[model samples]
Target chain A: MIQYDKISSRDAFGNALLRIAEENPLLVGIGADTTKSMGMQKLSEKYPERVINIGIAEQNMTAVAAGMAATGFQVYAASYAPFSTLRAAEQVRTFIAYPNLDVKIVGGLGGLSGNIEGVTHQGLEDVAVMRSIPNMTVVIPADAASTEVITEEIARIRGPVYLRLGRGAVEKVFDAGYRFQIGKANVLKADGSDAAIICNGAVVARALRAAQLLDANGVKARVIEMPCVKPIDADAVVESAAATGAVITVEEHNIIGGLGSAVAEVLGGRRPSPLLRIGIEDIFTESAPHNDLLDRYGFRPEDMAARIGQFLSSFNSKNEEEA
Target chain B: MIMKSSVAELREAARLIRRDIIDIAYLAEGPSHPGPALSIADILAALYFRVMDADPRNPGWAERDRLVLSKGHACPAVYAALAGRGYFDRAWLTTVRRLGSRLQGHPDMNKTPGIDITSGSLGNGLSLGLGIALALRLLRKNCGVFVILGDGELQEGMIWEAVMAASAQKADNLTAIVDYNHFQSCGGTDEIVPLEPMRAKWESFNWNVFEINGHDMEEIVSRLEMAKRFTGRPTVIIAHTVKGKGVSFMEADNSWHQRIPSKEQYDTAMRELAGGSE
Candidate 1:
């Protein structure tokens, strides 16, 4: 369990990176003019010598970070999710991932975290682009505590990693003393489940809330928080599917290639189940409040609760009809 | 003058590199731009054999000088020099673009040894080299970075983007050489993109510019030696040479950009390459 005040994922990344930088002098923080946006400014201020502010060149910044990593420096290149994952993808592919350089790419405002920044700012396609690259560890933290913990974990591990952190405040999912294994999924609520709600990133909190709402309506729902999207815990996913017979994956990214897509891929090829993937459709986002955007994109807790109710009702009707 | 023995060995290495180019192209049935490679044969030989401090056994030496072959299609020459320097088994030079060979049609850094950056896409090498130069400078490493850009490749907008950044950063430890072979794959560079006043263009970008006859061993080595002594800004060596220097039928022929020879033509080319005794 992480013993810290509830904070946003981006803020947690900021706080956690500062702690790691204290011990590792080789750890350098670089931002493509998004230090404050990604909450890397804290790390910058704490370790001024280690932080490199590369004005506004995202492409140059990525290549520069890769070069630094090649020369035996642990580099964390920070920027918004869309820009870091897509805008500088070629650089990440050629310099960082292909060469297997030690670059920790911290992408902030994943999914619709930057609600008001509109569709352009939303990173619905970030996971799709990053997960395709070989030797890349794709991580989407469920909340601030996990984000901080994962940031510390990747700093110790070598190779390229893409850590997605959300903007804005999020509810805490894990309690104090919860150990976060990098590629392991945390089963938040298990047993006595009518359906399983599997989610990642900050959307896990919403899934948890929806589970609570389902319990209030006489439906037991198990909420699972899957942080590592690339090397997904298939055992956890299969166990949830086996226990509940139906699974719902919630996330703030695009349904095409985000957490839902990853889960569907595992579930489709392995033990198949009736899986509902809740996320942004294949559409661009525009500037709006983060919460309002979440609501509009059908990712709010209420939306998730409604979806669970529909799945449970349908499952019950099918069971009764069989009887 | 200072490193007499090394320079003499490099000259012999240059002759071998020239011979390897003729042999590799003939074996693969792949016609490369021979003039550019023949002209740059001495420089490549000097760098790999004498000037650049590298480890063939340990290609990943941190302090080794970085080389980016911006004109990657000229790998026939580069592969020859790399083999001459013992970066890989010299026999591997015969499998230039064969299946499962480390050598690709273009240089792949992952597959090939001593290739600092993967570059087949023109206009990307300088930027990649710039990244390496900047990274080394940031780490306070005292190693030199070298990039060889083709004259035709200079037409790419990314090259200028890199030029502006290199100049702005004042990367003194980096040196860029333009293989001014006067011809591109299509035709003469002037007829294609018209890059006249090449030296002035580099100078305007705040680079220290030098022009030399690329094939002349003395000028090529002297300019490279001078580049080390001068500092405060990056240096660009614009080496002028004919397109296909050694073979009479292929000399100044743009058709040889990638045109392989017939059996008889191959024999003739070999004869011409071996001082035309046949």
Candidate 2:
């Protein structure tokens, strides 16, 4: 068993931002009254001049970020995922993405992380909305370690990027030495030729655990972490499908227009494999504890393991029947 | 403030910009917001030719004053002004909205010279301008950001949010000019949704409010200059204007908001703009 340190992705993002801002004076942080929640409070406190709190207005905050970007300021604006990607979506699309401005949008509390806040606060559809915009690079880091690396990488990259961060603490999936790239998938564990589990965001650690469970049951599973969903790692996805023959996608987002859809788009053209998507069925989540919501939505490690095992068995039986 | 040119010369420039606006609209052979575009001819002329500190030779000079046409449909007027000020070749005006033309129906900063920001969606420019103002202040760059908004665009809730933010931040380097043409796509602003008490509303937001006749080149220039001198708060110059100022048939007529001129109407408008007999 790997000893996992627990930390929230939002906290990692905040620390990474502060470190980057210290090196680059041109980097400005803007928040829509979500400084504390989005992990910008420390940056705000340290560099009071660089951080702007645009007070509860996501639309204006996005536009302001774009305006600053046009003047050659590397700007990052943060808010709750739903508000950042949906409420201010038009601003993000028009001012930032349309012009391909260098404004990094950090969406905290992505997926069901905003637990107990009910449907409005939860950001289950952020990936769907953000991925649809042209010139928008959508990134969902799997754990706190990767989130820090992703934040540093996005700050170095120029153009519009949507970085989705989770609210709750998650087990560290990557080591401190893990190098982050924008459009590459990180393969965590590859053992079995029976099935492959592709995952991202908060569910990646669970997917790894599921793969472990599958391995013990004599069904070897390959686990791939796809951090960047928009410019998805098509090469990795195709290779995994060709090797494993069956695929299961795990995410904390809606099954539509997310990791599953991205993988399907890749494989439907390149390689045809029986794929099962494990995520929230297209529906809003109710108020509950974050862990309970994760389990109920089929994001738990055991649940994902069981589903992948069932899929592998059915896929193998179908192949044998065809033979 | 020193006047570079006589008010009569500025009036001639405004007249020429109006003429160019009609010419571009006719050549584009597509829908154009002529009413709103014509309405802001004098304002655009004053800003481009007189009030703004910009170099036509070097359009991207770091210290140059910036303008964001929040009401992007009125781009023809800005295009004409940019050409008139020699930001680009005068012949480019004929290619407005043509296939692969730099002058898109709306302002695109990357494609067009002298355009600082891409603005088409309403209620975004003020916030964008506020952001630019903030950056300029932080960089210690002595430049001002001017954003032109349509009165009808005030209907968007985001505009109020920007208004509140601009005031709360005390963006003294920012100035917003509203072309109070009084007409929207559907009908008059009052008929659609009342925006009266507009002056009081701006004042309540802690903005320095200046009301002027948008068509009067002198008033436009003087007020814009006054805004530059006024420090401590951002300024909003409410320039009351007719929907279509020069063309008699289209003036105050909301039907012409997005109307492309027929040959007869176009000829009549060109003649009237040329100070010819009707």
Candidate 3:
């Protein structure tokens, strides 16, 4: 039995920020009245001079962060995913991205993590919105450990970055010793590729379990963890597709412009292969428990395993017909 | 210490800057916001020529006071002042809106030296200024951030948000100047959206409000000095002036807000600004 230590990505992000602040005194934190929720309260308390709560004004907060960046301060602005990535998107695009300021935007409660709050709070389309902006680096950590790694990495990078964090605790996908690199996908499990399950954010662990389930069913599936969605690892994607001959992309976001779309864009242009996107269709999610919502959206490990199996079976039959 | 320039000297600098504005507008291909630019010539003159601690040769000096032209469409005024102050060659002023020119239609800090922030979009300057003020405070730098906002830009909600935060933080190092020409694009400010109770608005937000005749060089200099002295809160200088103050035909006319002057109109403007053709 695998021992799983679970912690919220928000807590990991907050802890990482506190650690980062101790080393870099020039680092400043700005919040849009979401200090506690976005895991920035400890930083605000410890470094009161460095942390600024700009009330509920996300737009002003974003611009202020940019202004701080212009003055040579490494700034991180945090807010709810919807508010930060959508409400203040124009500010992010104009002030931070256009000027290419070194501002890191921390988006909390991405996707169905805010499931209990319904569509209003759920950040279903944040990835799509942020990925479209020029000069923006979009990162979604798979678990608490990766969240810490990603937080530290983005702070070191000298440009605009969007770090998406989940609301609740999730099973650990990587150990503390796991090396994190920007724009590189981590392969969690690899075997003879009947199919490859590419996933990111809160769904990576599930994809791993789905791969195990596929193994028991006599199908060898590879699990690839894509943390950086914008500067996507195109080589890893193409290699996985070429080796497996089938690809399944899973994300806790809309299927349109999330990791699935990013992977499709890479493979569709460079290498053609059978691909299946596993994510929320074009629709709003209703209020429910987080796990239940994941299940309802066909994102549970069992569902992923079943879907990948079906896709592989069809893929094999098609190949057989061609042969 | 406040730098001083005689009213006559400041007046001459303002007139020269106005001529430069017209010259640049004439050279540009499309319409530029010359009326608003001409309106603030004296204010810019008082700032660049007298008040501001900036060196044109060293535009990126760390201790230098920063200026954010929030009312960005009126960049002709800033561009001309920068040129007159020797931040760049005066010859480059002719390429205002030309392709690949550092002098973009609006201010871009990365592209242009001496521009502190990129601000063509209205209502973003004050917030950006506040950020710089906070940064200065954090670094213990004794520098001030001056933001020039358009009167019509007051309609944007983000401006008020920034206004509230600057006072709440007690950012004494920041000063916001409103170029209240009483006009915006399309019509008079009253017909569009009145900002008449502007003094009360800033005061209510906990800012130190100073009302002055923007065209008067003396008032512009003194008020800016006063704002620098007042500590523990941000200041807002409401400079009342006529739109297109230098030119007779363009003065107080909203249609001239963004209209490029014809050859005859440009000649008349230059002649009037050059002290009635010698």
Per-residue error for B23 in candidate 2, Å, reads 1.0
Best by TM-score: 2
Tens-place lDDT per residue, model 2, B23-142, is 876767757788889999999888888888888888888988899999999999999999988889989988888888999989999999999999988878898898898889888998
lDDT, candidate 3, A220-273, per-residue tens: 988899999989999999999999888999999999999999999999998999
Chain A (alone) TM-scores for all candidate structures:
0.93, 0.97, 0.97
TM-score of 2: 0.97
Q: Please give the lDDT score at residue B176 for candidate 3.
A: 96
Per-residue lDDT of model 2, residues A1-323, tens digit only: 64444768888899999999999989999999987888887898899989999889999999999999999899999999999999999999999999899999999889888888989899999999999999999999978888888999988889999999988787677866778798999888867798888999877878888888888889898889899998999999999999988888898899998889999999999998899998899988899988789988888788788888788788678889999
Q: Please identify which of the two predictions, 1 or 2, would achieve the higher DockQ against the true structure.
A: 2
Give the Cα error of residue A279 in candidate 1, in Å.
Answer: 0.5
From the highest DockQ down, the ranking of the candidates is 2, 3, 1
Model 1 docking tier (incorrect/acceptable/medium/high): acceptable
